[model samples]
Target: MHAFKRAVAPVLTFALALAIEPALAGSSETGSGGADRLVGGNGPDQIEALGGNDVVRSLAGEDRVNAGTGNDTVDGGADADSIDGGDGDDRLQGGPGNDRIVEERFGDDRIWGGEGDDLIKANRGNDQIWGGPGNDTIYGGPGKNVVDCGDGDDVLYYQRAGTARRSTGCERKVREDSTIQGRVCGQGGTDDADALRGTSSGDVCRAGGGNDDIEGAGGSDRMFGEDGNDRVFGRFGNDVMYGGTGDDELQGGRGADRIFGGEGADHLVGGYGRDRLVGGPGDDRLEPGWGEHGEIVDCGPGKDLAVIGPGDRTRGCEGVRRGG
Candidate 1:
C-alpha cells in the first residue's frame, strides 16, 4: 500500500531566478509519436508531437516539456528539463548538463546521463528511479521523492522527509553577519543547513540527509545518520548521533561524542567530542566525540527518556528517575 502524495512545489514565492529557456515557452511542438527533433521555444507539446527517435532540444535558458502521453525521447540542451509525463514514460536528459528534472504523474520516466545531473522526482503515484552523480538514478516511487546526490560520484539517493530537501535560488537568502532567512529558517542565527557552514565548531549538529558521507572537518562536531547508510566525522567538536534505520559509521574526529543505533546494525563512535554513546536493537559498537562537554556521562534508558550526567542540574533521565 503506497500513499506518498505528490509534492506541490511551494509557489517559488519569492522567485529570485525564473530560469528562462530559449524558444520553448511558446512553440511548434508535437503530441506523441516516433521521431521529431524539438529545437527552441516553450512547449507543453500541447498537441502535435514527433514520432520515432524524436529529439526535443532545449538550448540555453530554462525549458519545460509536458512530454505528454508517449514513449518519447527528450534532449534538454544547456538547460534544466521540467517534464510532465502525461501517458507514456519518457526519456529526458540535461545536455551540457547541470540539469534539473521534475517528474510528475503519468510516467515511469528514465532520466539520466547529464553533465551536472540534479533530479527532483516523484512517481505516477508509485514510480521508481534514481539520481546520478556518476550515472545516478532516482526511484522516487511509492511516494514523494526527496533525494539529493550531493557533490560526489554516486548513484541512487535514499528518500526522506520534505524537511530534508535543500533549497536554491531565491529559496536561499543569506543576510550580512551571516543571517539566513527564507522557506527554511535557520537555527536562530544561520546554524542550519541553508548556509554552507554551521555555527560553532564544538557545537552538536544533525546535518540533514540525502545520500551522503559526511566528515566534521575542523571542529568537534556531532552527527546523526538518519535514513541511510553513511560515514560521518567529528572533525573537532563534541557531538551525538542516531543512525536511524541504516548501516552507519559514526566516527568522532578530535572531541568525544555520543551515538545511538536506532534500527539498523551499525558502528558507533566518539570521533573527537568526549561523549557517551549507545545502541538500540542491533549488533553495534561505541565511540566518542572530540574534546569534552564537561564530564558527560550516560546510564542507559531510564524509566523516563531523560539523560542527565555528573553534577548537572538537568534532572530528566538520571536525576529524577523514580517519577512520583
Candidate 2:
C-alpha cells in the first residue's frame, strides 16, 4: 500500500525523466513520488511505482509490479507476472505469459493480455480488454465495455444494466441482472437464448431465433419475438408486441396495446385498456384483463379459445370462454 498525491501528468513526465533514468535490467527497483519510468530485467524483479502517472515494464522473467495511482501504463513483458494498476485511467499489458492483471481503479482503461492464459479483473469504468491467445478469464466492472478474447477459449463475466457490453471470441459469457435503459437486442442467427429488457422511455427489442425472454418496462414500446419459444411482457403504456413464428406468451400490461401471437400455439393476455389481440394461425388462448371493455380479439385459423367481455369484438375464434 502507498499514499498517492495527484499530480499533473504532463508535468510529471518531464520531472520523472530528469529525476531518474531507466534502471539496469533484471534488478528490483522502486520509483520516486513523482511519475517515474521503471524497467525490469530479464530475471524476476519487483517494481513498485508509488504515485503519479508512472510507466513500468517488466521486460522478462516472473515479475511483480504495482503502479499505485494516477493514469499509468504498466506492461508485463514476458513470463508470468502479477501487475496491478492501482488507480486512475490505466493501460495494462500482459505480454506473452500466464499472468494475473488487476485494474482496481475508476477510469476508462485498456488492457491486453497478449498470449498465454491470463486472469484480468477490470474494476469500474468503461474498459476495453483483449485476451490475446490461450484460455483467459475476464471480469468487467460497471460501465460499457468492449471485450475481445482473441484466439482460444475464454470466459467473460459482465453486468446487464444500462451498460452496453460488446464481447467477441469468448466461448462463454455470463451476465448479472441490473436495471436496463433504452433498447436491448438479442444475438441473431444463433440458437443462443437472450434476455432482453427496456426502459421507461419508448424502446425497441428484437429477439431473434432463440428461446428468448423480454420485458418492456414502461412507455410505449415495440417488441418482436422473432423465433423460438418466447415470452414478452409490455409492462406499461401503449405497446406493440409481435410473437413472430413461434409458440409465445405475450402479456400486454396496461394501456391500449396491440399484441399478435404469430404462427404458433400461443397465450395472449390483454391486461387492461382497449386492447387488440390477434392470434395468427395457431390454437391460441386469449384472455382479457380484469374489468376490461371495448377490446378486439381476432383468432385467425386453428381451434382458438377467447375469454371476451362486454363491448369486446371477437371473430375467427372457435371456442369462447366467458370472463368473470
Candidate 3:
C-alpha cells in the first residue's frame, strides 16, 4: 500500500504541473545586460530590460515597462501604462491611453505622448516631445528642447531663459531666470489664438498672429502683440505694450505704463498709473485718466481719437472724438 501511494503521488504531481504550465508560460519576459527585445502579452505586465540597447513593446493591458541603461525604444500600447527609460537616449511612445513616461538624465530623447492626457517628464538632455492630441503636461528639462503640444489645451513647463521657437494649442510657463526675467512667444509664431499670462517678475510676452489675449500679471512687463487683432493687458508694475498690427486693444492696468497701438484700428485704455498711449497707423482710440496719474496720448497717424477721462493730459490729439 505504501509503494502504490508513492507512485500515485508522483503521477498527481506531474499532472498538476502540466495543468499549470499554460497559465504560467510565456506571459511576461525580461532582458539581460546585452541588447535585447522584450515583448509583453495581453495582460497587466511588468517588463524590465536592464543595461543594454533594448526594445520593449507593451502590447496591451496596463503595463509597467522599464528600459534600463541603454538607447532603448519603449511603446506603451493601449490602456494606462507607466514607462521609464533609464539612462540612455531613448524613444518613448505612449500609445493610445493615458500614460506616465519618465526619461533618465544624460541623453537626448524623443517622447510622444500619444492620445489621452499624459504626463511626460524629460530628464536633462536636449529632448523633443510631442503632446499629441490631448491635454498633456510636459516638463522640458534643463536643456534646449522643442515641444509641440498638438491639439487640446496642453501645458508646458520650460526652462528659465531657454528660447522656445513655437507653440500651438498650449499654455507655456517660462520659468524665471536668474535675472528674474520670463520671456514667452518672443521670437516665434502661433497657430491658434493664445492667452498669455506673465509672472510676478519682469516678463516679456509676445503674441504672434491670431487674435490673442495677453496679460502681464505683476512686476515690470513688456508685451508685443505682433500681427492679428489682440488684447494686451498690463496688470501691474511699469509696463510697455506694443500692438504690432491688426485692430488691437491695449490696457495699462497699473504703474507707469507705455502703450503702443501699431497699425489697424485700436483701443487703448490706460488703467491706473502715469501712462503714455501711442496710436501708430490706422484709425485708433486712446483713453486717458483711467489711472492715478495723468496720461499722455499720442495719435501717431490716420484718423485717431482720444477719449479722455477726468484729469487726463493729451498731446497732438485734437479734432478727434473724446469720451471717458
Candidate 4:
C-alpha cells in the first residue's frame, strides 16, 4: 500500500508542474526545433519562434514577433508591433495599433491590420490582406491577391504580372501599362504619368502629380484632374470632368455631362448630349456644340470666352466667339 501511495504522489506533482509551466514561461521565449506554442504576458515582449508550426500570442504592449520557419499563427495584441511571417503559410493579426507585417515566400498568407495606419506587404503566394481602418498602404506581389482597405484613405500597390482583386476603399497605383479590369473608384498615381482607364462600370478617377491622361471609357464616370497639365476623356457614358489646376483639357463624351475648369487656362469641349461647361477661375475657352441637342455654359469668376458652335446655346457667359 505504501509503494502504491508513493507512485500516486509523484503523478499528482507532475500534473501540478505542467499546469504552472505556461504561466512561468509567459514573459519571453525562443522556440525549439519542434512545433511549439508561445504566449506573451501583459508586458512588452520579444518572441522568436524559429523552426516549427508555432503559435504566438503577443497579448499586450508593443511586441515584436518573428514566426520563423513553419506554418504559424501570430496575434499582435495592441500597441504598435512589427511582425514577420518568415517561411510558411501563416496567419497574422495586428489587433489595434499601427503595425507592419511582412510575408515571405512560399505558402499562402492571411493578414489583418485591425486598426490604425498599417503597412502590409505580401511578397509571394496567394495572399489576402484586410486593412481595417486608417490610411493603410498594401503591396501585392507575385501571386493572385485580394486586398480590402476597409476605411480611411488608403493606398494599394500591385504588380503587373499577377491578378490583384481589390475592393473599393483605397487609391490604387497600377504599374505602367497595366490594366485594372475590375471597377475602380479612387485616386491614381504618385508623380508618374499614369494612363488610368476605367472599366465598363461607372467610376470616379483622380490623378496625382505629373502630366496624366485619364479615360473614363464605358460607364457614366467622373474624372478629377488634381494636378499637372492633364487630358481627361469621358468616352461613352454621361460624365463629369473637373480640371483642377494647370493648363488642362476636359472632354465630355456621349451622354449628358458636366465639365468644370477649376484654375489655369483650360479648353473645355462638350461632345454630344445636353452638357454644361463651367470655366471656374482662369482665362478659359468653352466649346458647346448643338449636335442633336443644346448645351449650357457658365463662365464662372474668370476672364472666360465661349467659342460657340452652330446652333449652340449660351447663358451667363460674358464673351462669345463663333467657331468655324
Candidate 5:
C-alpha cells in the first residue's frame, strides 16, 4: 500500500504544479499582454501590440498606433488620427475629421477614410479602398487595385503608357504624328475601368443625381452623365460612354470607342483611333476629330462645328496624316 501511494505521489505533485502555474503566470506578470484595453484620453498617445493577433484601440486624443506585425485589428478611435501596420495581415481605418491610414506591402489590404480630407494607401499588394464623403485623390501602382469614392467629389489616377513618335526635325517633332494604341489583337486582356468619371471643380457631380461633368482619364473606361449639363472626357483607351440627363459633351479620345448623347442638346466628338459616335436625343452635334495628327481643338458641343465621316480609320476630317 505504501509503495502504491508513493508511485501515485509524483503524479499528484505534477498536477498541482500545473494548476498553480496558471494562478502565478497570469497575474503580476509585466507586459503579460493582459492589457486588452488602454484608454489614452485627450493626450497624444501610442499603443504597440507585441507579436500576436491583437485588438489595439486608441481614444479621442491625437494618437498614433502601431499594431506590431502579426494579424491585427486596430481602430483610431475618434478625433484626428494616424495608423501604421507592420509585418502581418492588418485591418486599419480612421474615424471622424481628417485621418490617415497607411499599410505596407505585407498583406492583402483594405482601407477606409471616414469623412473629412483623408489619406489611405496600400503601398503594396492587391488592395481595396473606399474614400467616404469628401474630395479625394486615390492612386494605385503595380497590383490589382480598386478604389471607390462613396460621396462628394474625387479624383483617381491609374497607370498609363504614353506613345509618341518623334523626329529631330529642324522644324521640330511635328506635334502631328502622335497617335494612341490601346491593345494588341488576339491577346488576352483585363477589364480595367477608370473611375476618373464624373464632374469635379465643386460643380455638382452627383453620381446619378446632380449635373456632373465626368472624365475617364486613363485605362479602358466608361461614364454616364446622370443629371445637369455635364461634360464627359475620356482621355484614352477603348472606351464606352453615355450622357443621361441635361445637355452633355462626350469626347472619346483614341481607341475603337462608342459614345451616346442621351437627352438634352448634346454634342459628341470622336478623337483619334477607330471610333463609333452616336448622337442621342435633342438637336445633337456629331463631330469627327479635327486638327493635325497630334494636336487638339477645344471644341465642346457648342460653338465648335464638326463633321462626322465613315467610322474609325476614315480620313474624312481635314487633319495632317502620319508621314504626310
Candidate 6:
C-alpha cells in the first residue's frame, strides 16, 4: 500500500503540473482580459491574447497568434508564422521567416514583416506597414495606409486610389479594382521609387527619381521613368516609354510600341508587333522585339551594341549581332 501510494503521488503531481501549465505541454494558450505578457517556446504555438493591451512573443517555430482587442504588441520570432492583431492600435512584428500577418480591425496599427518573403495585410484604419528585407507582398485594405517595402523586390496591392502610400524599393503596385475597368494615370515624385501602371484608355504615367518600375497595362499609354535605375514595360496596346537617366531597361510590348532609353547604360528590347527602340547616350544594348517586322533601332551616341533582326532599320549602332 505504501509503494502504491508513492507511485500514485508522482502521477498526481505530474498531472497537476500539466493542469497548472498547459502551455508547457504544447497546449494552446488563452490570456485573461487583463494585460498579459505571454511567451511561447521553440515549438509551434497557438496563442490567443484576449482583451487588454497584451504582449505576446512566439519565439521560434511556426506559430499562430491572435492579439485580441486593446493595444497589443506581438512578435513572432523566426520561422513562418501567422499573426492577426484584432482591434485596437497594435504593433505586430513577424521576425525573420516568411510570415503572414493581418491587422484586420480598428485602430492605427503598425506592422513589420521582418526578413523572408512575407505577406502582410493592413485592413481598416490608417496603418503603417514595413516589409523588411526579402521579397514581400503587402495589401492596403481601406483607409490611408503607408507601406514601406524595404529591400528586395516587393509587390503592393491596394483597392482604390490614394489608399496606399508606398515607400522606395517597392517593385510592383497592383490596383485591385473590383470593376474590370482600367485606371487613369499614376504619377510619382523625386524622393522615392515608384511603380506606375497605365489603363485601358490612353493614359500618361510619369515617375521621378529612385529606381522606378513602370508598365503600360493597356491602351495607348505614355510612360516616363525620370531618374534612377528604371524598368519600364509596355505590356499592352500601343505604348511609348522613356527611360530618363541611370541604368535603365525599357521594353515595348504589344501593338505598335515606341521605347527610348535616355541617358546612362540602357537596355532596350522591342516587343511583338512593329516597335521602335532608341538608346540615348551611354553604352547601350538594343535588341529586336519578338516577331518584329520593319522595326527601327537607333543607338544614339556612346559605344552601342545591337541585335539586328530581319527587316530592322538600325543606325548609330556598332558591333551588330544579327539574329538567326
Each candidate's number of clashing pairs is 76, 2, 1, 0, 3, 1
Query: For model 4, which pairs clash?
Result: none
Candidate 6, residue 209: CA error in Å? 38
What lDDT score is found at residue 32 in candidate 1? Answer: 44
lDDT of 4 by residue, 1-324 (tens): 223223332432342232222332236768895787777766667888998987777776666788998987787777666788998988778877767677855778877777876667787688777777876767677677767777886867677444444444666655423342322445465566666777799988987776676778679998988888877777568899998888887867657989998888887877656788988888887876332345678877777889775666776667998752
lDDT of 2 by residue, 101-152 (tens): 7886688887888787677778788887888888776878767877887788
The clash tally of candidate 3 reads 1
lDDT of 1 by residue, 256-307 (tens): 5556656656655443234565656555533222123342333233332322
TM-score between candidate 5 and the true structure: 0.38
lDDT string for model 6 (1-75, tens) is 223223322432232232222244333678998888777777778899999988787777777798999998888
- lDDT against the true structure, per candidate, is 0.42, 0.76, 0.71, 0.72, 0.49, 0.75
- Minimum summed lDDT over a 10-residue window in model 6 is located at 13-22
Cα RMSD for candidates in order? 19.5, 21.0, 21.0, 21.2, 24.0, 17.3
By how many angstroms RMSD does model 3 differ from the true structure? 21.0
For model 3, residues 1-324, the per-residue Cα lDDT tens digits are: 223223332332232232211222225667889987677777667888899988777766767788899988777777657788889888788877666677856788878777866667786888777778776767677777767777776767676344255334566554422222223534434745776778888888877777776778668988988988887877658999999989997877647999999999998877557888898888887875334545678888887778775567666764454444
- The residue-by-residue lDDT of candidate 5 on 1-324, one tens digit each, is 223223332432342232211221111211124323333444456666656665555555546666655665565656556677665666565656455566744766555666644545455555555656654434443345555544655544333121011101111111111122222212212222112232222122123544444555446666666665665666446677777777776766545567777777776666544566655556665654421233222223323333533332322223322211
How well does candidate 3 match the true structure in TM-score terms?
0.47
Which residue pairs collide in model 3, if any?
A: 272-291
Error of 2 at 182 (Å): 29
